[model samples]
Target: MRKVAEGVYRVPARAANTYLVEASKGLVLVDSGLPGSENGILKAIAKLGKEPSDLKLVLLTHRHLDHIGSAAALKKQTGAKLASHPFEKPYAAGTLVISAPRAWSLYGRMVRKLTTLEYWSLKLFRIIKFQTTHVDLAADEESVLDGVGLDGSVVWTPGHTKGSVTLFLNQPSVAIVGDLLRARRGRLVEPLLMESISQTEASVKRVLDLDPEIICPGHGKPLPASKVKIEKRIVKPVVVAKKKEEEEDLEELTSGLF
Candidate 1:
């Protein structure tokens, strides 16, 4: 585990990164990594001189398999309250399964296809499978870290997923964005896959407007927010109707899954 901020530690569990926030009451974990990652996370807590039971909450930014894989095991082991956006509740609760996201850009499209292929390949070989979990708190725009003894707020930053969110820390001015943006060769860039490019741009602007000193992403190393050049290259013109149609299609595709 590496410390990204005052009380924030980043733990690279497996496929995705998981964060541990030191709260007044206990530890608040942000995004449990891939399946079978509970051991590493629990060890991270122990490294901080805390116990498994000291975990107070598990905050999931979205319902992606990589991000939510270990959620169920961790919750069962630590008995921490699991929290995620309302739209992600069913998938996180194992009631619904999510399909691969849609993408507009060529790179994003390729990434999506590769991701879908990898998931099915792993399943076909019986190498891995997604383990569904449950969400205890339906976090939204109004949700604040104060309820969990932390000084921060949950901001809805959809596009990568309809339920995507960024955790903004008040004291250190850090934004723990889950796939809202990623670091590539020391520069902040958008994720490789997104449900809507328009919503992604809007969400990126919202986080930039916050003027966070540091931005911690779900996949890469934390970087200074100053590295982000929102106006120069991030913003682009996208058809609103097309984006809406994509969103509807994504919902339809995932909804059809049992």
Candidate 2:
């Protein structure tokens, strides 16, 4: 776990990252990470000199398997209320169907490039370990998280998922964006999978409007807000140079170039 702000700690739960906010009432957990991460979460909390019961709420950015993997288990253990966007509530409640994204962008092409054997191995793991839980609270709009000490609000930045949200903090101008943007090499790109391309583009503009200084992404290291380029479409690669080496670097940094 690492502290990204005054009272915010980013905890890594395997591939996904969750946040712990030291609020007035207690600790507010932003995301729950993957399944079977309960042990790590508790250990991290204890390391921070906090107890499991200190957690008051679990806010999910969206209803994806990796992001909400430990929601049910953590809520049960900590007795915390689960919160999500209204549209995402059904997904958290296990009533919505999730389909793999269409292979249209560079990221999608890279995902499709995986060997069949490797792909199936990963699919099998998620199928066996994935679990869904109920959401007790819902955010109606870009409202402040009442009761939490931190001056934070949920921005409805949909596109990566229809119900995606970005949590913004006033003090540090930080944004906890769950899969809205991803770090590949050192630059930001559209997240690996997306539900609606148009909505995702519009959401990027909304995020820029907030002018966050620091971005804590769901899958990569915390990056400066300036590293992102909203004008660069996910399907097109931004070639930085004509030299062979520089071109190679771009290819390595981005998933697929066509």
Candidate 3:
């Protein structure tokens, strides 16, 4: 766990939990820790001597089960605003995207219990009816919550997921990159989940061009600017699905879990 800057506490747990708990606005949890690590997050926050409710925003880089495992639980307890990219909303809302046979095996049959890789990493939710105040941010657009603690633009970085995002600061130039990078206990790309292999390659190059001083990856240790090397050129992701269709999925993911 690396503190990129003051008030920005980066906590990477077993699978790399990145929480950007701030002081100005409140606690901005970049990505909620794993389900089992929820209470630990609370304790760690307490250790920092920051009020738990300072937690305002819970920005999800992508909608993987590990990333959003305890998101609903945290929102209920802290009333934090759970922000996510339009692409990942559906999976987070508890409607697992069970891939078709071959795709399912390759991607992850998350709907079935004890099947998906994340299941081994974290136990599947029985009810998974956790609730939160959802906030969907656009990929091309930038969301600046002034009064809130979060002070950065959300950039769309697909590859791991079509709508995967990265929160970057203009000053510190620290990026809270989700599964887009490998930095924690494990060193590899996001476990076998891919829509378009080409898109993932493009997104990796996109973050490098930003020239961020700090690289806050989703699953491992954080790297400094000098550590990140662009293996390819940056190219804007070609969003495959229609915007309207993505919006509907986003609403359902954030609104309710049926």
The prediction achieving the highest lDDT against the true structure is 1
lDDT of 2 at 170: 80
- Per-residue CA lDDT of model 3 for 1-258, tens digit only, reads 456676667776535576664636777777776565567677667877776686777788776656776777777777777778766777676555523111112123333223544554333444443333355443334444554745567778887677788877766677778877665333333323455446666776677778887777776667775665433322222232224435655998988865
RMSD of each: 5.1, 7.7, 8.8
Consecutive 10-residue window with the lowest summed lDDT within model 3: 98-107
Instruction: Kindly provide the TM-score of model 3 when superposed on the true structure, using C-alpha atoms.
Output: 0.71
Off by over 4 Å in 2: 110-127, 141-144, 234-258
**Candidate 1 — what's its lDDT?**
0.81
**In model 3, what are the clashing residue pairs, if there are any?**
13-17, 27-54, 27-55, 159-200, 183-220, 183-221, 184-219, 184-220, 184-221
Residue pairs in collision within model 2: 24-149
RMSD of candidate 1 to true structure, Å: 5.1
Global local distance difference test of model 3:
0.62
Give TM per candidate: 0.85, 0.82, 0.71
- Of the candidates numbered 1 and 2, which has the greater TM-score value? 1
